[model samples]
Target: MIRLLLVVAALFGATGVMAQDFPNKSITVVVPVPPGGVVDLAGRLAAEALAGELKSSVVVDNKAGASANIGATYVAQAKPDGYTLLASYSLYHEVNPLLFNNLKWRPESFVPIGRVVVTPSVVVVHPSLPVHSLKEFVDYVKKNPGAVSFASQGTGSVAHLGSELLKQDTGIEMVHVPYKGSGPAMQDLVAGRVQFFITAPPAVMGYVQQGRLRALAIAGSERHPMLPEVPTSVEQGFPNFQLNPWVGLFAPADTPDAVVRKLAAALEKGLTQPKAIESAKAAGASVSFQSPQELAKTVAQGRAYWAALVKAANIKIE
Candidate 1:
């Protein structure tokens, strides 16, 4: 019994040492998407905040391709130390599992560090839509039915899922036009190739301001600072239409609890800094730090939510 206790103590002691010496070296944050996108921006901001908080050189490595499997697999197989981390978002974590038949990694692949930033999706329409409000837009869509088309970043993305939710709630019919990325989607939206869109404030704000697009309401509960005049769907009488994409940090599975807590502390405090807040706000992302446990809860809720959504939407990758 004494020898057993000694062995347990030794194991915990080693874990303690590891947590204490935690980020002794430069940390690498792997962004699954290419540079210059919303996820990439959020990842870079998170890396900057961590560097300031932990006093370490944190670098962002972009490993883009294959629906984020490449970068996710890289971090999933990385050493279970605090140094290697993944900056991932909602679609990658929640929807990918429901969309893809074969994934390289599962939810157990990483331990939740915390949620970093949340980018709100807004419902915007082309200036030619003749809809000044969400109700008017809904009415028009109901009248036109399948004639009205809405654009999404891809199948099984937040836009797609959110749009599906909107369909279920409003009972409106619109053709889904999936794009490779938001850039092309936004361009086509501005050109009137598509009549409606629901995306983050960054890509749509400029167009709305320029009169190229008309924003009806934010999909979430709160209005974005960039587009303060636009109300939320909840306020506009669509309480069910809330879909905000968030980015989270994670380490490989089996990471020590102490280490995860320490990193979560840094992440929470770093997100509160004015620089971090300003930087995130500038990128149309808001810093809302979630503790490790809180993030895990959110992940679970998102999983069930997306699963039901996929089943209802009849979403298929192929």
Candidate 2:
């Protein structure tokens, strides 16, 4: 019994030492989407901030494909030694499994380190569209019926699901146009190919300011500070129209609790920095942090909500 106790003490000591020296080398943050989008920008910003906090090199790896399954799978299968991490939104973890059938990794494949930021979706219309407020847009869509089209980042993206919820709520029948990415979709919306687009603020706020597009409503619980003139969907009479996409940091499941805590602490510290906060705001995301336990609960609640949404919308992807 004494020998067994000595062995256990030695094991704990070794683990403690490893945790103290955690992330002694460079770390890789995997982004499940292409560079330049909101998620990608958030990942890069997070990498920069985390590098400063850890005093180690942090690189962002863009492995975009298969609706974020590719990069998520890469991180899920990576070594759980605090070296490889995932920087993605809740959609990849909470919504994708409900939408796709071929995903190799499940939500349980990751251990939440911390939540980074939450960005509200904005509803913008092409300049040519003959509508202004959310009420006008809804009325226009109802009148035009199949004459209007809405663009989304992809078939099963948050943008798509949000629009689906809008259609269901307002009883509109606009056609759905799926784009490879938000950039192209916004381009098409600007060119007047699509009538309406629901996307992140960073993607359309500049255009709205330039008068290329008109802001209708923000699909959030409250109005966004950046777009103070635009009211929220709730204020516009759609009380249930809140869709905020949140990005968080994660490591492969089975990562040591000590390592996870260290990383989470670094993330919380980094995200609170003025530079990080400004950078995230420039990307149209508010810097927000949540502990691992809080993030886990958030993910659980989001999974339940999104699962029912997907089922209700009949959103399916092979």
Candidate 3:
């Protein structure tokens, strides 16, 4: 019994030492989407901020595939030693498990480090759409029914689900066009191949400013700083119409509490830095840091609400 106690004490001591020396080497923040999108931008920003705070090398690895399942599984299977972390969001953390059958990771697979940023989404229409606001868009879609088509980053993405929620709320029918990535979807939307898209400001604000696309409405309670002229969906009377994609940091579950606290503290402090805040805002997101417990609760509540939406929408992925 004494020998067993000694072994346990040594194990705890080692963990303490490891946590104290946490991230002594390079750290990788795995992003589950392709490069060039706002999420990737957020991940890169997080890496830079963390590198400053931790005083070590922090890099991003884009393992984009399978609707964020690839990178999520990779992170889930990574060593719970705080070196291999995930720069992920609602889709990977909360929604994918509901959408993917035989999903390898669960909500518990990740230890929530902290939320990095939250970017409010907006609705943009092609120049030819003839809709200038959310109400007009809804009315036009209802009038056209299956004739009008909408673009999504992918079938299971927040864009897709948010569109579905819009359809359910307003009883509008539009054909769904899912793309391989947000880049392709934006490309087609800009080309008028798809009539509409719902995405972040960084992705669509340039088009809106250039008059290439019409900004219908920001989908949250508050209007975006980048597009202050655009009114929110709530102002248009559809208070339920909202989709803000938030990115958060996570490590594999079973990561030591000491390491988790250290990383979370760095993230919290990093977010307060003027550089981090400005960079995030420049990328069309705001630096909104949530503690692990707060993030965990948000994830759980989001999962529940989204699961019901999925069921009601009868959304399926082949």
> Model 1, range 119-197, lDDT digits (tens) per residue?
8988889888889998898898899889888898898777778888999889999899999988898889999999888
lDDT of 1: 0.89
State the lDDT of candidate 3 residue by residue for 200-297, as single tens digits: 88788889989999998898899899999999999999988878778889999999999999989888887788888888888888999899989888
lDDT of 2 by residue, 1-318 (tens): 999999999988987898999888999999998888668877887788789888999999999988888999999999888899999788888988887777889989999998889988889899798888889988988888899899988877877888888888888998889988777998899999998888888777788999999999999778887788999888988888889889999999989899999998888898888888888888788888999999999999999988888888888773
Looking at model 3, report the run of 10 residues with the lowest lDDT sum: 36-45
Cα misplacement distance, residue 41 of candidate 1 (Å): 2.0
CA lDDT scores, all candidates in order: 0.89, 0.87, 0.88
- Report model 3's TM-score to 2 decimal places: 0.93
Each candidate's TM vs. the true structure? Answer: 0.97, 0.93, 0.93
User: Model 3 RMSD to the real structure?
Assistant: 1.8
TM-score of 2: 0.93
Residue 12, model 3, lDDT:
99
